[model samples]
Structures are given as C-alpha cells and as structure tokens.
Target chain A: MIWRLAFATMLVLAAADKRSGYQDASPETRAMQDDDASNPGFLWVQQGETLWAERTGNAGRSCADCHASIRGVAARYPVFDARLGRPITLAQRIQQCRVERQGAGPLAPDSDALLGLTAYVGLQSRGMPIQVSIDGPARPFYEAGKALFETRQGQFNLSCAQCHDGLAGQRLAGSVIPQGHPNGYPEYRLEWQGMGSLERRIRNCMIGVRAEPFAADSPELADLELYLGWRANGLDVETPAVRP
Target chain B: MMRRRFLVLTGSGLIVPLAPMHPARATPVQVAALIAELVGDATLRDERVKLDLPVMVENGNSVGMTVSVDAALGDVRSIDVFAEGNPLPHVLRVRFGPRAGAPRIATRIRLATSQTVTAVAKLADGSCWRDRVDLLVTLAACID
Candidate 1:
C-alpha cells in the first residue's frame, strides 16, 4: 500500500513536467521535422499550396481569393463559429467553405485534398502559439471535453489522462508516451505513410485502447480537440510534423 | 540428485544457443541476401551515404527519416532504402534524373521493431556506397 501511494505521487509530479511532442521525438525525427526540404509532410503542404490557388466549383474562387494569406490562421481554429452557433474545427470549416461558398462537393474525411489543404493552412501557422478560446459560449463544450479526457472507458478501462497525462515520458510497449497535444494536426505519420488530421489521430488512440471511436466530425471529437487546444495553450504549433 | 540436476542444467545450456534467436521472421542472413540481390556484386563502401533516423521512435507506424549522399561523390544514379526488421525489408527506391543536382531524399517509414535501417546508393561511376543506423522502434507497425 505504501508503494502504491508513492507511485501515485510520482505520477502526479510527472504530470507537472511540461514537454512538447518535439522534445519527445528522436533526434533524427526532430531534424527531419525541423527542415522543410527534408520533411516528408511538406509534400502534402506543397499539394495544398496548389489547391489553395486553383479555382474550384461554380464560385471560380480559390482559398486565396478571400483569405489572401493563411498566415497564423490555423492557430485560432476549432474556434466558436458565430454563424454555425457552435465550435468548429479547421477541417469542418474547410468543408463548410466547399459546400456553402465554393459550391464544390464536400471532401471526405482523411482524403488527400482535405489533408493537403489542412496541412498547407496549418503550415502557415508553424511556430505560432495555440490560442483557442474556451470562454462564454465555448465554455460548455470545453467542460464536456475535459470530462471526456478524464473519463475512463474501453476494455482496458483507461482514459487519455492515464497514459498521456499521468504516464507521459514513460515507455509503453517501447514507445514514450507524450502528453496528448493537438498542435501538430495534418501532420505526417511514418506508420500511415501519409498525412492525417487530429481527428484521425484521436480515433487511432481510441482504437489503441480497444474502444469504439467516434465518427469523424463528431461533437465528441471536436470538443476533445478543443480541450487539447486548451491543454497545449502556449505550445508552438508544429504542423506537418514528422512522427514515428 | 545434485549431480543429476547439474547435468540437466548443462544440457539445457548447450541446446539454447542452437535455437533460433528470432523466430517468426526473416533471419539476418536472409536480409543480407536480399541486400545482395538488390545491389548485386558492386563494391559497397561506407563513405558518402548518410542515413538520418530517430534514435528512439515512440510509434513504429510513422517514423521520420532522411537519406542523402554527398553531392561531391560524382553523379549519382539511384538510392535504395531497407528496413531489415520490417515485414517487407525494402522500404523505397528513389531514382534521380541526370539533371538532379543533389541526391537527397526525405520521407517516413514503418518499422516492425528495434532494428537497423540501411541505405545503399548507386553512383554513375558504377560504385555503391552504403550506410546503416540502428534505431529503437517502441511500437510495432503493420499490426492491427
């Protein structure tokens, strides 16, 4: 019993140690992510650049037509959309633009075009601190996301906090557990051999714990994303990050 | 009884080394044969080729990697990368055009476990340069 108490105290102290995903990455991975020329995720970012300039749908307008520049735009995403009357992620906003503004068909989740555009937009905000607001109207969703982050589920009876928050920096099945931060969505994953969104990654975690994942664009995922954004409050975004 | 137990322990020790160290996977000899088949009888030197990979990978599914050869090593023809521990060792093969200025390629690859990743470069002068880095993959990829 005394040993159990000491282990619990150790976990609590470990949670206080703040480290970014980059710090947890191997040296080679960090080098690859740090350089644009050597980073594979840039391939998707390049594709996104092309799509940003090309005219699409009946609107004959591109993403560049209105936004002009995407600099620092992604850092403020998963924001409360006044028009939608709810919090929406960057991926949802991209879909919204396609359906409502562009007149183009909605791109499927995890599709190349969607990932490319998201990576490109996210790349623009590289190194900017995440600044998501969970105040006023966004407060309730934030609360729900916090509840989900702490709630236990799955066959393993594990919560996100169990590993990411409590056991972060420790080895699990040989890999170090990192604090579950969403600063690098639309990031390139070596395992996937492609770029993926934060939602896809979250679903992957759910599956890892033997839990049924929420569908793409589910409120649960969005709220969880919002909570993660809040968790990573001041961490600089590293979009298109190359992860193992 | 003590003598009988001692004899049994000695016999077991003798049998252990003969047993396969890694079962259910290709052996190092097999992986070397595959590399030989790819590179042929070319003289593989250790210079010029550079392989960059994480020393420790948290997830085997998406480990970042970069392989490059010194441009000073004359005209380069192609580069082949291999992950000896993966289910399929051959990760990628990149060929450069005649006008290709620098022979540099960057990408991500999946690893089955902790193992050495090798890169072999074929140059225009009919020579092959090789380099390898051993890395730890915490999580296995290609598994559901």
Candidate 2:
C-alpha cells in the first residue's frame, strides 16, 4: 500500500514536469543531432528522398505525383480518417496510399523501403510541433490509448506512465529514463544500428517490461502512438533523431 | 634519509618500465597497442582528432558518437574507430579519397562495458593522429 501511494505521488510530480527527450541528452549527442552533416540519420533521409520520386506499380505514379511537397504532412499524423472511420498512423497512411492510390503492393512493415519513405516524409516536418486531434472522430481511439498508457499489463506490473511519467529521469539499470515522447521517429537508434519506426521502439519497451507486444502495424500500437502524439503535442518533430 | 631517497627513486623507475607487463583493470596501454597495430610503424601524434561521446551514458547499447579531424590536417587517408571493451574491438573504418571533403564522421556504436574508445586518423603525410575518451557505460549493449 505504501508503494502504491508513493507511485501515485511520483505520477503527479511527473505530470508537472513536461520535459522533452532532447533536454535529457548529453551535449555531444545534441551536437550530432543538431548538425545535418554529422547526423548519420541523414543517410536514410537521403535514401527516402530518392524513393519519393521513383514511379512504381500499375499506375506508374510516384508519391510526388500526388503530394508535390510533403512538408508539414507528418506533423498531423494519427489523424482521424473519415473514410476509414478510425485513426491511423503515418505508416498506415503510407500503406493506404500504396494500395489504394498508387495500386502498388503493400511494403512490409519493417522494410527498408518503407522506413526510407517514412523517414523522408517525416523529415519534412522536422522542427514542427505535433498537432493531433483527440476530439470528434478521433475521440474513442484517443481514450483507448490513454487507457493503455495507464494500465499495468506487463509481467513487471508497470504501466507506461509508471516509468515514462512517474519514474522519468531516474536511473533504471544504470540508464537515465526520459519522458517517453514520440516526437522524433523513424529515429536512428544506436542499438538497432539503423532507422526504425515508432512502433519498433514501442515493441522494445514492451519487451523490456515483459509484456506481450502488439505486432507491427497493429491498431493497438497505432492508437497508442496517437496518444503519445497528443501527449507530446508541443514537442518539435525531430525525425531521424539519433538515440542511444 | 639520502640513501633511502635514492633507493625509492630507483624502485619507482623499475616499476614504471614493468607496468606494461602486468596490465591494470582499465589501462590505456592495451588501447594504445591496438592503435599501433592499425597504423603500423607510423608516428601517432596526439593532436587534431576530436572524439565526441558522452562522459556518462545510460544505455551502452546505442551510444551516439562523432569523430572530426581538423581540416588543417591537410588530407586524411582514413579514419578508424575502436571500442576496447567490445568483443570485437574494431568498430568502423572509413577510407577517404583525395577530393574527400572535411574529415568528419558520425554514427552509433555499441559498448560491451565501460572502456576507452579510440579514434585514429591516417593522414596523407603518412602521419597518424589519435584521440581517446574513457566513457562510463551503465547497461552494456550487444549482450543479448
């Protein structure tokens, strides 16, 4: 009972401290992230730029043909699509475009090509604040994500809020925990040694907590991502961010 | 007291030369030997190269790092990186051409434990410049 009460107090304290992951990074990491020439994440961005103009599928139309400049497009992801009657992540939207508009086959969830395009599109929104709506059609999914964030389902009996919200900045097994935000992704993680989507990072966290992670591109993960977007509303998009 | 001082001085001199024979827990001597092997017979001057890494890292699995050499070094032939504590000490080796721009490279690398990371630059002049930083890695990477 005492442990539960202490955790509750930590949660309240964490909610009051709204800090971005960037604030927790060391000076050298910050320098690598701020400079384009020194940031390796730009390598994937370059690949994405090439894929943006390549024509594919039966329609023989490239992404550029539909959206001339994708600048600021990623900032509004996890948006409510009236046609789909639900919320969808940027990855889901890309798949939708491929299958419906471009008449191309769906790229694998963790494919290099998919990551390239996602990184490319997300780069356009770099430095822009995320603005996801939780009202109107996006309401139900947003609430579900919030529930998931608060519920403790893992073997460790830890919720996302328990660590990200309550225990952020505290050392866990020798590493500092930052406020879990989804501002920068398709991020370049040093552990993965490559660019990965937000969903992939989420899966890592799930595994860390001994929880059964949702499969890539699962609606649950997308919804959880939407909640993270809302949670990190004002944080600037740092797509292709370098993370340890 | 004068005779004792002489004996102490002689004793210290002997220990200094024999220190390399018995490697300490975290000695730079091993790291230096590794760098010597990479740039055989070349004089490694401790100048110009800058290795940027965090002093304290929470997760050793994916540490962001950058290596930049002074453009004044004229022309750099190659840049090699090593993490002494990793199973494979060699991390990355990047070669540059004559027209290669600035000698700056950045990437993420894994650290098996707390150890010194070394960066060596072989210049066009056949001279080698090196820099090393001792980092405190909390949770090691590549352990799975």
Candidate 3:
C-alpha cells in the first residue's frame, strides 16, 4: 500500500510538471529554434510556403485556396475523424485532404514535401497550447495509445514510460532524455540532419528498442500520436523545433 | 590526421605541390595552407578575433557557430570559417559592407567529426586575425 501510494504521489507530481522538450533543451538549441535566421527547420517551412500556393492534382487546387483560417489548427491535431471513426494525426489529415478533398496523389510518407507541408501547417499553431480531446469516440484510441505507451516490448524489454517518464532529465549514454513530448515535431534533429515528423521519430524510437516499427499510415501510430498529444496537452506547439 | 595531396598550377605557369588535402575533408595542414593563400603576404595575427562554438557537441550534423572580432569591427572586410574535419574545410565566408555594424555573425555548420573550427577576419588593409575552437563531438544515442 505504501509503495502504491508513493507511485501515485509521483504520478501526481509528474502530471503537474509537464515540461516540453524545449524547456529541457540546451540554450544553444533553444536559440536556434528561437531565431528564424539561424534555425535550419525554417528551410522546410519556406518550401512548404511555396507548396501551399502551388496548384496541384486533377482538381488543380492549392492548400491556400481552402484552409485560410488554419491558425491554431495544428494544436488540435490527432483529432477524432467522424468518417474514419478513429483518431487521425495531422499528417494523416493532410494526406486525406490532399487525396480525397483536393484530388491529388498521395504523398509518400515522411517525404520532404510532406514534412515541409506539415512544418508549414504546424507553424500556424506555434505558441498555441496543444488542445486535444480524449472524449466520446476518441476514448478507445486514446486507451489503446495509453496501453502502448506502458507496454514493454523489444529486446531491451523497455516501455516508453520506463525511460521517458521515469528517467527523463537523466543521462542515457551522452543524451539527456526528455519526457518524449510530441509538441515540437517536424523538428530539426542534429542526429537526423533534417526535419522529421513525430511519426518518424516514434518509428525511430521503436527501431531503437529493436522492435517492429508500426507502418507510417498504421492506426497504431495514429493512436500513439493521440496519446502523446494528450500527454503534451497545454504545452505550446513548437513546430520546426531544433533538437540535438 | 589523415590526408590526400593535390597539385595546383600557379598564375605564372609554375606547378606547385600544395599541402595534402584529405580525400574527404580538410586536414589542419590543408586548412593552414588555404588560410595562407587567402591572407597572401599580409600580416596574420592570433588576436582580435573570436570563434564561439560548443566545446563539446552531441552531434556533428548542425552545430551553431558565432564569430566576432575586437574593437576594429567596422574596418573588417570579411570573415572565413574552416572546419578541420568536414568533407569541405572552408564551410562559410561572410563579406561585410561598409555600413556593416559590429563584426559578429551567427550561423550553423555541419561537422564531419571532432575537430577544431577556425575563423579568420580580414581587415580592409589586408591584415588578417584569427581564432579557433576545438570541439569534441559524440555520436547520437538513438542509433536505429
């Protein structure tokens, strides 16, 4: 009972201390993300800005033609899709809109064009607190995501919670692990040498643990994205964040 | 430490053997030679310049760098940056205008490995000043 209570107390404290990765990042990295001139991620944003206005597909429609009021749109992502009856990540939403709505070809998962668009759209919600709901139809996916977050797998027999939740701010080899918040995504990682989506980073982690990574368009990743989004609730969206 | 040599023809039609340039990146000797070529017969000093880079870097992909000079900021005409362990040693060059303010620039560069990053500032009179910082770069943890 005492151990359970101690764990519960720790949970309460951890919940209250929901810090974004930016808060944990070094000052140099912070400066890079803070300054548009120095941050390399802005290069992707620039590409995205170009793509937004360019007409494409059989419909020859542009993203700028339709989604004019996209401010704060990225913050409320991994939202419940009524047609799909499941949660859809922002990237998936863009893919869906590009194909079905705009009559365009499906962009390859994690492509620069796709990442550029993601970064571009995500930039609209910068400084806006993440606001996703786990209510009603979204609850089941959220539960699945929560389960996956806590599930132990791979050769290391580690769960996302073990390191991200329990050992955050602590050193693992040469890296200081953050809480695995998905706030700053399509972020420029020094390791990646380019911008990458949250899904790609998630898959990277899965592979890091020697586990089978979920498919790019897999429902599991969407579920996981939902969970991470929920976990990172209230943190400002830091699109195109620079990370070491 | 590793190097590859190359031959260059002088303007007077004389072939001269320059310092060894690494097959992939620039070695210290090659970088020094490049700096010498840029400075020509002008005086080169180890003062009036500052190279700001992290002493230890986690990854070599994108390292932020800041270069500055002493009080003679306005007369500074240009600055050249060289990385000792990158595929290309001369990473960046910034030429300042007459109306340019304090001689300071912040930029990001990719390092191939752990090595010294050198920056040289050329004044209007052709005199050059420099500073260098040696940084240790470690590999990434999430090696997927």
Two-way DockQ contest, 1 vs 2, winner: 1
Expressed between 0 and 1, the share of native interface contacts present in candidate 2 is: 0.30
Sorted by TM-score, highest first, which candidate order results?
A: 3, 2, 1
Model 3 off-target regions past 4 Å? Answer: A1-13, B1-44, B71-78, B93-104, B122-126
Docking class of 2: incorrect
Q: Deviation in angstroms for A43 in model 3?
A: 2.4
Chain B TM-score of candidate number 2? 0.71
The TM-score of predicted model 3 comes to 0.83
- Over A114-216, each residue of candidate 3 has an lDDT whose tens digit, in order, gives 9999999999999999998999999999999988988877755667876677666766556677889999888998777788888888887776665788987
Error of 3 at A161 (Å): 1.2
Off by over 4 Å in 2: A1-16, B1-53, B58-83, B90-110, B117-132, B140-144
- Poorest lDDT segment (10 consecutive residues) of candidate 1 chain A: A1-10
Write down the TM-score for model 2.
0.76
Per-prediction backbone clash count:
7, 0, 0
DockQ of each: 0.21, 0.15, 0.25
Q: Considering summed lDDT, which 10 consecutive residues are worst modelled in model 3 chain A?
A: A3-12
Q: Which stretches of candidate 1 lie over 4 Å from their true place?
A: A1-17, B1-25, B31-137, B140-144
Whose lDDT is greatest here?
Answer: 3
lDDT of 2 by residue, A55-130 (tens): 9888898999989788898988889889878889998898998988888999999678888889999999999988
TM-score of chain A of 3: 0.95
